[model samples]
Target chain A: MIKVERLVKAFGRQQVLRGLDLDVATGSITVVIGRSGGGKSVLLRHLIGLLRPDAGRVLVDGADVTRLHGRALDEVRRRYGVVFQGGALFDSMTCAGNVAFPLREKLRLRAAEVATRVEAALTQVGLEGMGSKYPAEVSGGMRKRVAIARALVTEPEIVFFDEPTTGLDPILVNTIHHLILELHRKLRFTAVMVSHEIPEIFEIADTVAMLHEGRIAEVGPPAVIQASPNPVVRQFIRGEPERAEGA
Target chain B: MTERPLPLTLRPLDAIGRWAIAVVEALGRFGTFLGQALGTILTPPFKFWAFVDRIHYIGYRSLLIILLTGGFTGMVLGLQVYFTLVRFGSEAYLGPAVALSLIRELGPVLAALMVTGRAGSALTAEIGIMRITEQIDALTVMALSPIRYLVAPSILAGLVTFPLMTALFDAVGIFGGYLVGVELLGLSQGTYFGEMQSFVDLSDIMTGFWKSLSFGVIVTWVCTYKGFTVGHGAEGVAKATTDAVVLSSVLILVWDYFMGTVLP
Candidate 1:
């Protein structure tokens, strides 16, 4: 449902994505894992036209997402859900209001309809009762779940999670992973999760793409990647403890 | 060891000159921005109540403090001027001198400075906070132009508030002048009123009011631009807020000088 071809993104002199190519298939979970500042977020931002690629193109569905402008661009944005890092919830709003924001802002749905959908999405993320809680009042795990609810509130064709499991406790991480699996089985919507939550991602993500040194080093199923002889692939899958020592 | 400095036309010195030129260019750009914001206010699709609501916040709500400041400033100025003139036994002229200086100069300048402290910093901090938090981005993504929703309301507020603020300052300051002239300094009330009426024309008050109106525009423009253009992170918000206040104050002063020359 999404494609990036020879994407060249740069910040003044330093290039973040040096002619990197990636594709996210329809109704599939594609997890992108990479080192920090390795163009994972840049690539995702390009998908939503938040950060314009210096060159090449990002196609969402069939439209050139990089080329869409104004109302047309916003229309494209409505087609996807984005869960930003740190949740990025509006502090002024409660969890329900946060989820309902896009519905009210973009879809112009009636208040009742918006609330109904928000509750349903919250239930999907196992956050059915925490709707009225403010961001500060909620736990970190709940905030992330609320963010996921906000992302899925639109019932978009695709959902993008910047990092689903980064700050979560083990139990919460497992919950999110199982929720992803459950959502995949039920909704069958396209999901692209950029994460260094390697193990949980392997448990849920059908296709894993590893970005390395400004390009995709490997793209395959979890087992195929596990046995791959590529030094970068092996080291990445070795998880944080070994990698921190390597660093 | 480093060599001597380069000439004005040469690389290093030329860079300083270039930077100076850039600052001037930025000022010109800000002027254009002010013009555009003002133009938008006069054109179609005016949100009338929104303007009134803002004026109520920016002007009426802040009036008490403004009144106190203006009253004290005039009282202080009256005492100083009267006492100084007493040394020459020309204390009666104190009325005309205080009237002219306050109406011609101090009124607008002080009002604008106060607004810079209150509204300009408020606008910058509000928008700057919104910016780093992606609220502005969220607005745009929702098909709301940040310029219309965020900026235009503020510009309208500043425009309406400054003149009203000046009016308050003029009244309070003149009252303070009377308090000092008639009560404290032992000058007659009749003589003080007569001197003020005879010396200060409608044009002098108009000049001060008009100068403040322009100053208000500059204040909102600088603050809104800085807030909307803040870079990522906390430091950027701090820098934007600081730049907004400083730039607004400087613009008010510079425009004050220009009005001094241009207005009657």
Candidate 2:
């Protein structure tokens, strides 16, 4: 339910996103794969109205979020949930408070109702009985889970994951991916995730888009992308460095 | 090879020009941030609890320091002023001297400096950490204005607390002066307070009030803005905190001078 058209963003002399175009289908998991600092997070920020593009437009559900500002931008963002790489849980808040924040702020529900939903969200993420603990008190894996619970608590129409599994161990990475898959299966929220999980992502992603040189080099279903003819795609999937010209 | 002599003709001028431009740009950004923060305070759906929480943080928590510093400052004034006035056989004027300095100048300026060291640094570090950690971004994506949730309340609290704290400082400082002049230095108690009552006027009180009010806004504004615009990483937060405190302290002193010159 999101479309990025000719999105161009630059930082001083360096260009990060150059005429990058991407489309995210409704209620599907679209994982964007790219090299580190290839503007994946920057692109995601633009989609979520966190960054204004230097040029081009980001349309979510037909409204050009690029043009929206102030209250209008906020209104559009209300439907969005983002899980930052660090989880970004308010450190001063307990796990339950973090999850209940959006509910309390946006929904203005009664305290009893907010607590109930927070508990349900925590339970859904296998974090039951962990609500009272502060984010600092939790393990890295549990923090990520808490972040996910916070994101999904509001039942947002779309969720953006910015390297949610970046610093986790292998098993925890798999666990998080599986948890995301399960949640997607249940909630059916449209997801646009930026990740470097490679083959692991192929199993969960409805569509995989490979970003290269500030553009989408390849995009298709998992099988199609795996078997693609493009050398860049092939090289990336094989985890090989650039070959010498004649070696 | 011998080192080449640096070109000194236009370099200094160019450096000055660049510095001037940078200063102007920073000022513009700060002004815009102040406007936006104040606007958030004026807007609807005001977060009353957030404002109260900040008052507790920036105001109530700062009481002990203000009192301690104020008391010592007054005692110092009493000691020094008594010695100076005694030389001229004008020791009777010690009360007015201590009272005027504390009420009109030292009270607001020193209290602000103290708060800058205490609450201001913490505010900057807290918000800077939040910025680097993406908590601010999280708030944004959740459709919450970080300015409203963070900046507005802080600015409001500053506005509320600065003057009140200044008043507290003035009172305690006067008492401190009384302790030193009348009790320690053998000055008559009635003469000390009676002289202060005769010389200190409402205008002098108003001067401190105005100065403290402005200092409050400056401290909170600079601190919050630095945190909100922190560069990146741990280093960024550290630098932001340092900059916030340093800038707020400098601004407080500078503003105090300007106000001192203008106010009655």
Candidate 3:
């Protein structure tokens, strides 16, 4: 389980997160949604310890990850797999090498084992025979899959996806979401994803947390959030103009 | 009412203060990066093959440029020195003058500048691109040290190869000088060779070596830091690469002056 308490973060004069709080139950897919620049990615960055909150705490299974440093921080990070917005594949390496990076760097797996694990992860992402291709050679959707394979190659307990399907077409989006569902079902890893796909992504989310004005405006199952009575939530979901100023 | 600005009397001081702060901040950040990169130079998870691969790329692949510039510089130095020496019937001193300048000053400085233009710019652009693309962040998420995985190998390779490149530059430069002095200017080969052998000291050679070594550190350090901390997008990468090449070249010449004054 992860708990965030009154997370306050600021960039110079711009206070992005102000007294924000949220939670993630163990082994659940929590999809955080928000308007562009509403700090959805910022919150995710904080959760992963990429950006420490200016004030408040991020507790990952009761461990204050922000306070941890050096080897302790590294150990905490190893338990996570993150798929960045751009896939973030090392351009110089082949797809196989990118997938095998964490394993080779952290694990003492044999060459044969590394190759096997890489192949398995690629296969899981439906990219079995494309191991030798570089990130530049693959399409945008395929690179995302490679990123997913790299993320899961370590068999992490948790995976963080930052706008996984944002840039893809509708078909590729469905494919990616289904792939995420298939992998989540098989791997059983806790998933915390930030997505812009509204009605579409609600189908796969176990909990949809709506971030607005730096705090979660509403958080519940998909049906509850869709039917939420809060004006801000309604206006946001319907893509409608505000009914009143500061309502 | 509009708020009043600061008094005009203190405006220049304020601007100066702001400029000073930015410079100090940049220096502090670069120093921290250097310290971190140095710390990881000998730690565990040693990527020996990666280090060697960088050497092959930075050292062996750079031979052609080093040779071309070195040869031209030596030939030019020889021609000019021979002409100047013949004025006072001191044409024989052409060998020692050209040899001393090549081995002591031109070889290390020119070689460093060339490498900075070629390798340093490339390194800065590469790292900057990685930064914009979030590959560095990917490494962090993987529990891997970017300094260890990305920077140490380049720095180590620069250290290992800069001197070798400088030596090659000096050899070609000396030969170029020899051609201009003996073959073109009708100077005796024995006089030219004998003068260089007698006049050039071990300390002169050591001075060039030391300078080139320092140049290697400055180039790699400045370039990598620029790339690692690039701002955002393609414009940022281009700016960082330009800054790296310019700053490294300026620092090399500045440091060379200081070293010349200090070294024997």
- Comparing 2 with 3 on lDDT, the higher-scoring candidate is 2
Give each prediction's root-mean-square deviation over alpha carbons.
4.7, 3.7, 2.3
Q: Candidate 2: which stretches are off by over 4 Å?
A: A244-247, B1-22
Q: Order of all candidates by TM-score, from best down to worst?
A: 3, 2, 1
Q: Write the per-residue lDDT of candidate 1 for residues B130-171, one digit (tens) a residue.
A: 878766765554444567666788888887788888878877
> What digit string (tens of lDDT, one per residue) describes model 2 on residues B185-246?
99998899899999999999999999999999999999999999999899998899999999
Q: Evaluate every candidate with DockQ and list the scores.
A: 0.35, 0.85, 0.82
2 or 3, which is superior by DockQ?
2
Per-residue C-alpha lDDT of model 1 across residues A61-139, encoded as one tens digit per residue:
7888788886688778767777777777877689988999889766889989988899898898988888989988999
Candidate 1 or 2, higher DockQ? 2
Record all residue pairs in model 2 with backbone atoms less than 3 Å apart, i.e. clashing. none
lDDT of 3 by residue, B24-58 (tens): 99889999999999889977777798789888877
Consecutive 10-residue window with the lowest summed lDDT within model 3 chain A: A238-247
Candidate number with greatest TM-score: 3
lDDT of the structure predicted as candidate 3: 0.91
* Superposed Cα deviation of residue A210, candidate 1 (Å): 0.9
Top of the candidates by lDDT: 2
Candidate 2 residue A192 C-alpha distance from true site, Å: 0.4
